[model samples]
Target: MNIQMNNIHKSFGTNRVLSGVDFDLREGEVHALMGENGAGKSTLMNILIGLHARDEGIIMIDGKETYFANPKEAERSGIAFIHQELNIWPEMTVLDNLFIGKEMTNKFGWLSTKEMKALAQEQLDRLSVSLPLLSEAGACSVGQQQMIEIAKALMTRARVIVMDEPTAALTEREIQKLFEVIRALKKEGVSIVYISHRMEEIFAICDRITIMRDGRTVDTKDIPETNFDEVVRKMVGRELTERYPSRHPSPGRKVLEVKGLTRQGWFENVNFDVHEGEIVGFSGLMGSGRTEMMRSLFGLDPLDGGEVIMKGHPVRIRKPVDAVKHGIGFITEDRKDEGLILDFSIRENMALTNLFSFSNKGFISGAKEKDFVDTLIKRLQIKTQSAETAAGNLSGGNQQKVVIAKWVGIGPSLLILDEPTRGVDVGAKREIYQLMNELTERGVAIIMVSSELPEVLGMSDRIVVVHEGRIAGELTREEATQENIMTLATGGQ
Candidate 1:
């Protein structure tokens, strides 16, 4: 399959998402789409699959002008899209999710359960995934759910696959497996449109790359012909001096100390301490119990046995409100589900944690709330039309900034951040790192749990490795390296 999109233009109300964009895909080649958030990467692909109509453009597939009426039409034509936000039916079983609309039927129009299970198992086996077909989709981890999405796309036998942020939730081992699958697919004459913010993955796997900025095509070059700095400069339209901002730390008294923290069947006997004005990074594999431990600390999950000490005294955190009242803020990993309310306006979401500060006599002060929201919006450099704009309408990077701003408004002594830059762009990630530096300078302690090893190493003052729900080891900034961190995370001496 060969696809060519020329002069694509799209808009939602007054917001122009794509303007005069050109993208093409050749058979048996992996083409990459690189851009900052809201740079029209996803929007352009959405238009191709008929989720959104292009106001002005020409789409030619195999030298024939074509436009899909809907995603179903595109799927039938061997074009499949694995979206950044997954489309799993949480209430349904994994098997049901994999074959939702394309179930097999017998001669009498009866559903062929045996055939479907066999087919599903075959697809999963190809990807080296082990999942129970009868288990509810909601019970799976984010990484497992990502694999399920990939398997669902492969089940269609798509000739043209558009994968947006496919590796964001995957572990190192799974990513290698996916790269192998991509290689096999290319050998079978399948074309791929890869969209991601990770520069390493883009350069590693993509044959050609297209850069977009502010809803317009910037440039397209062969992957080998372009370098990381050049790609970032083209995408953001400026020079990014540093990927991770440098911070000078001056440690103070201990802000948070966890002793014998145990969550039954999850993490056990975890112990660590984060000092004031320091950033403690939690590094591990996807299911190494890093997120589970953070959830227990934030009161989102129950702790079987543990001691949480804050400011030299033991504290009890039984709920989110309790944690908040104790001057602790948590930014969860799954931001769409746990951190932000999509339907609410930016101001409303930012004020959720600090409502009491803006309230008097059981009545809310709109002026105070607006003032606070405006301040954080400017501080965090969040791009939106206005404070009245719905959070869901913003780009992925802006939504993450909003989630961070929400916690920053609460004036926390200790903040827990999980996967803070999972899907964010390079420019926005630098800004976030700067913000973290500023926060630590103001004497706030941060506990960051991340899957990206580079990020964990670059930003952490102290690194703690988690392996199978236990604290395997801790490394100082001078002692930590990628090899040693991975070794500890995998239970190596």
Candidate 2:
């Protein structure tokens, strides 16, 4: 299907999300959509998908103008959207998830589980997905869950598929597999609208690129005619010279230490230390126990047998509160689920970690809250209408910055970040890395758990690679190359 959107205009109250944006895609090509948070990429797609009414625009599909009244109508028009965040029901089986909302019925209108299973298996086979049909979706690995999501989209028979950050949760192996599937789909003439923060993936798979900035179309160029720097320049309207901050290596005394940390099955015998004025990176592949060990250190999960030593003293951290009191802050990996309360406002979410500081004599002071929240909002450059705006309403990149701001409010001696810049754009990513550098300069130790090797290499003073729930190897900043890190991550010395 050839889709062309001309002069797309959408507004929410006073906020003009998409202002006269134009986008087009060919029938047998993968198109990339690039923009920073709040740049109106999502709003443009939302309008196309019939989730929001366009204030003004003409949507021409296959040279015929059409209008969709709702999401079902849009789906009927052969347009399907796979959201940035995982949208599968955790309790539903993989087979059931694929056929949901578009189930096949028998002659009497009864559900046909046998047919659904066969169809789901066929779709999975097409994508080279190897996951159990009967298993619950939540039980599957992150990469497998993403595959199931794509299979669900394929089952819709969508001529045009809008995939929003589909690879944010995938591993390298899984990503290669997904790219293979995408290539196969393109061979079958499937039009894919790929939105992502990863530059390499975009250049690798996208045939055409449409860059958006500040609710307007900057330009659209063919992939062969463009490069990464040009795409980023178009997205942010400026040259981003440094991808990461220049941090002077200055290792101080050890501020945080883990002695023989062991979690029953998740991880075991993990030992690490974070020094003052240092960024220590935990690098490993998916299911390599990187996240599990961090969760244990944060007191979110049980550490069967371990010792958390802070400032040369063993700290008894039985819960998150205990960890917080001992000056430890954790930025969770799943920001939507664990980092922020969606129902709450920006002010409320930012104050969650430091409520005690804003409250006085069993009462919270509005003035104090405003002062602290306002300071952090400006400091973090969080783009929001007001502090009263709901956190869920913010774009993904801004929401990530808000999460970092919340943790920073606690004045932690050591902050642990798990996949800090996963879904953030390049501009926001550089800002975040610069922020980490400034924090380290203030004598705050940071332990970053990241799957992106480039980030691990660029930001860390020390690298610790994990394999099979154990510390695989450690490398200094001078010695850690991409190849060496991968070798260590794969259980090398």
Candidate 3:
């Protein structure tokens, strides 16, 4: 089947997001879509999936003009989309979630548990995923949940599948498995539209590439006919410089130290020291305890055994407030859940951790809060209509910048960022890298957790690898390599 989108145009109030955009996906081929943040990649995908009705367009399915009023209609037409955000029913079991809306039934209209389980098992097996189908969806790891979402799409017998940043949270091994499944699907003549920011993966897996900018189709090319730099240039409208900035260690006194930090099954015996002005990276595969250790350090989760030494003093951090008072800031990996209050305005979100600074006695000073937010907004170059605009309405990359601004407003001595550039585009990623360099230059100790090996190697002064709740190995910038990190991360030591 071939999916062709012709001259799509959409507008919201005064913003004309998409304009005469055209794209296509051929049978048994993986076509990648690349663009910077706010480039209408998600918008176009939403239109294709029928989440948003385009004001003008012709969508042809198998060379026949088709119109879908909703996602259900699109799904009925053999179209399915796996969004970047996992949409799973956490309270339900994996099997139930997989076949929820499209459940199998017996002649008497009773739920066919055996049939559904068998089908779900087959889907998971095809993906080489080993998680139990009876387990609650929330009990699984982020990467596992992602795979289940993919399986759900496959179960629909979707002829044209759309994957949005499918491997953003997956480990290298899991990504390899997913690539294998994609190849299998292609062999069966399924047309796939892949969306991702990882240039390496795009180059490795895509049969053809489409670049979008400002809601317009910029260019489309065969993978063999184009290079990574050319694709990035088309998406960003400019040449992208070095993604990670060079950092020189200032070597001030130790600011944050963790000794024998243990969180039972999550991580154990994690010991490291971050000195003032140094950027230390925590690199590991998914479920390798990097995020869990960071959560424990920031007092977001309980610690079974360990000690956190802050500025040469052993401190008991029982909660986030304690960590904040100890001059530590944490930017969480899930920004939507933990980083921002979506209903609030951008200024309000930015002033969350530092309300006291803008308060007089028991009441907040409106003038001071405004001044503070305005300064940070200008400094960070946050793209917003106004300071009063809702933070949730911004693009993913802008929202990430808001998260960083929220913490920096409090002026912490140590800052921890997890997957800071996970869904961010190449242009915003450069800005984030520059911001980290600026923070380090100001003598702020930084701890970064990243899944991208190139970023880890290029940004950090030292890298620490964790495997199965234990410290597998540690390497300096000079010694870190993809092979070395993988060997340690997979317990090959």
Q: Per-prediction count of colliding residue pairs?
A: 0, 0, 0
**Per-residue lDDT of candidate 1, residues 1-493 (tens digit):** 9999999999999988899999999999999999998898999999999988999999999999999999999999999999988898989999999999999999999999999999999999899989989999999999999999999999999999999999999999999999999999999999999999889999889999999999999999999999999999999899999889987999899999999999989999999999999999999988899999999898999999989999999999988999998889999888888889999999989999899989999999999999999999999889887999999888888999999999999999999999999889998899899999999999999999988999999999999999999999999999999999999999998
lDDT per residue for candidate 2 within 152-269, as digits (tens), equals 8888888889999888877777788889978888898989999998999999999999999999999999999999899999899999998887889687899988889999988988
lDDT of each: 0.94, 0.89, 0.89
Worst 10 residues of 2 by lDDT: 138-147
For candidate 1, what is the TM-score? 0.99
TM-score of every candidate: 0.99, 0.96, 0.96
Alpha carbon deviation, residue 399, candidate 2 (Å): 1.0
RMSD of every candidate to native, in Å, equals 0.9, 1.6, 1.6
Judging by TM-score against the true structure, name the best candidate.
1
Worst 10 residues of 3 by lDDT: 242-251
What is the alpha-carbon lDDT for the whole of candidate 3? 0.89
- Measured with C-alpha atoms, the lDDT of residue 405 in candidate 1 is 97
